[model samples]
Target: MLFQIEDIITKMQDDKTGGVPIRTVKSFLSKIPSVVTGTDIVQWLMKNLSIEDPVEAIHLGSLIAAQGYIFPISDHVLTMKDDGTFYRFQAPYFWPSNCWEPENTDYAIYLCKRTMQNKARLELADYEAENLARLQRAFARKWEFIFMQAEAQVKIDRKKDKTERKILDSQERAFWDVHRPVPGCVNTTEMDIRKCRRLKNPQRVKKSVYGVTEESQSQSPVHIPSQPIRKTTKEDIRKQITFLNAQIDRHCLKMSKVAESLIAYTEQYVEYDPLITPAEPSNPWISDDVTLWDTEMSKEPSQQRVKRWGFSFDEVLKDQVGRDQFLRFLESEFSSENLRFWLAVQDLKKQPLQDVAKRVEEIWQEFLAPGAPSAINLDSHSYEITSQNVKDGGRYTFEDAQEHIYKLMKSDSYARFLRSNAYQDLLLAKKKRGPHAYTHTSCLRACVKKAQSQVNQQDDKCLELHLRKGDQGEYQPCVCLGIQGWSKSSKGKSLAGKRLTGLMQSS
Candidate 1:
């Protein structure tokens, strides 16, 4: 039996192409003056659409009412009521206070009108935002299902690659083969539609019409039948994989387009409103406070500070340490006199081989994790240890700085080398100009004491050589006698220097 109107289970409203694309009611409201009362909006919907159905009008009105006209989406117009529950608008600019005004609850209903146009325009905008979001969601779900199907197919392909172990596998295959003619009605229909490529075969595109051909003129118009597009095949899978590899081409294109469109919208919109500046927001529709800033300054390694005082909804990372970390790490790098030098110098590598921090991280995970390689056999890996490598000098990535750290912490010779990179600059300055370069008598003694011990353990005469290269840059080498060398060499330096000599001669 053919279906009639009474027999129809799904109407256009209920057809669920995901959801109906209703533009944000708030925007439409904004275009008009004010329509706080339900009746006014309901009337507008009726006059606007020539909608005959009372229920449909009521539904559309409810959509507007729910939005409460503050946000760009939904009924952002705040429908203030004395007693009402608070809920967030699915879009921007809406606050619960709009609907639930703090002191104004005496009236059963009150509509706020910043301006008459603000009310109408907001309703229309809300309508547009809602509809576009719904359209995007419907499309997004389609993409998601496609992705899931692709993932499942990959898993199936992986299973097919494994060898069958049982002796009766052929018998099992025969049984599966006999039943494999079917994939249920829905899946079979999908499978058929997929096989039909309008591009490859002309029959697939046969008189593309929304419904049955107009030639078959009849009383009722059939709803459009959309044939599903076919997915890529095994050959196409290779191309898809290649496409996935070029992520910048696919993902970035959409993102780049969106960014360009947004910029164009801003640039064009600025002429309409001169307040628009690259520095600050000019659009009344958009909020400047939409984005938050990290105002909290927590830690100061410069001074001792404690943990966990300030991560809040309005702002997070408040402690001095948190704010200072980025600055201090950038400023006070010990390796180079200035941090900008490393930043200003360009390296052609995607991530340079010479970037000690990155290389060390790779070497740490790749080479050292398996246990420090026997020094004799370590050269087989592709990561070459080149002399060009520079000290990372970045404190932020200290934990991630793989081998540079491992060599510092591990090898006896390297411990001295690690301890030594600091001293050679001062010492080099010293031998060239006699000894006035010393700034800290106390800290220098402690450093030299540590270096002396590390050098003494190994016998290459450990002559306190300056600058040997490896995972890190050539260190400013200085000697120490620790459980290996002497502590006094750095502290009581020259007993009395030429400054004292001059004083003695004067006396």
Candidate 2:
């Protein structure tokens, strides 16, 4: 039909025999018994080319208008409107916004130039759109083939080892049988195209013009010319089951080959060797069999503070209980002397001038002395400097010695302590306690207490009370001596208590 139209257009352009007039061209088109209606074009576009839906219809209409196609005055042709609802027409024939034709233009050359330019733009857009759609369809078919291959492999997996369901169920077999590629179609393996070998390109599969595979074309049951459609007999059912079984076998073979090839490729090309450094020898003193201590410190443990604290000397000083826990862990590693030396140095730092000399001497003997029973490992220079500092009792006494011990613990003992079973158990226990475990609603209680405790100082006989709100939101009263300098006094407490009591009672 396009060739026929182009042939007519070419004859109209010829000048040697005098070009065919517009009216003669119109007469020639009209003489054709089967004039292409909008419905026929739309149906061909949607059903044959698979371009359906309202949006596609609008796109086709816009392309036609831009390409300057003249729509004959008919019910079908008139319905084709631009997305903006404008009625378009051929050159020199104007249709205004109201969908009614105005006057024809006398300036035909100007109209011809405008229409040609619009056609050129629209042709480029149309070509790009067609290519893009074809590419999308190609990609869709490619993934479809991959998915089918994967599904076949899944069927093979189900039948492997005889332990994980040795046989496919009836429904599963039926599903795989339907998707199994026929002999001619099975020419393309996933690796073939993936390796950029165009052995069986998916583009050929997606394009209808290339023709469908033999199985798709021949799947329908044949009809005898002389007989009405024969009802399925026992023989036919047996044949179908046999065909399905054969298909299943073919699929299994295909997938098994693919799996074996993949395994072979992986074995041949993939290497698991990695560069690794030799591990350091384990310390003789740090035995894994050493027992852990369950010692509790004097201070109540603050789980929050422990979590927030860093692995530093200042953090250990701030949380005595966590520090104690860390020390116990280090004891299990046979490295507790590091912490002991650090703590001794810390204590010596604040010791009075009179006590500093004796305390420093004791610390040196215990942890810094050469051949000392509980001596901590340190560099020769550090050991000598520490010994000199202890004897001199200088400014920031034991400061350098403390830093040396701090680093020793931080590098070795502190790191080991964090990974120890004791520290892990502590972390587990804290996690079990959760955020609300240590929580108290002190603000509400303090508010009520302040409101009630504002009695005058002159009233010595007045009862001092401690109030607590139970879980039921009811206040319980108990007698207790008031602490000195309670901020809320008699005047404010009395006023606040009365207002709060009224509000609470009303609520």
Clash number for each model: 65, 3
Query: Which regions of candidate 1 deviate over 4 angstroms?
Result: 1-38, 43-305, 308-507
Model 1: lDDT of residue 200: 45
Tens digits of per-residue lDDT for model 2 on 48-143? Answer: 346758568656644443223324322122234422222212322121111221111111111222223323321223333343334333333243
lDDT of 1 by residue, 1-507 (tens): 112211211121232632122322243423311113344334445655688876687665444333322111122232322122222112211212222111111000011111112223223233333433343333332433333433543344346522221112222222211212122211111234454344343223222111223233221122222222465468756745565556535433578889998887676446335454442212324533321121122121211111121112111123334333322432343321122121222221224334646644443443334553311122322123321123332222222223332332234322232234332343343343221112234444665555544432434333442111212231233332212332234444332222222332342
Off by over 4 Å in 2: 1-300, 310-313, 395-397, 438-507
What lDDT score goes with residue 275 in model 2? 24
TM-scores of the models, in the given order?
Answer: 0.18, 0.28
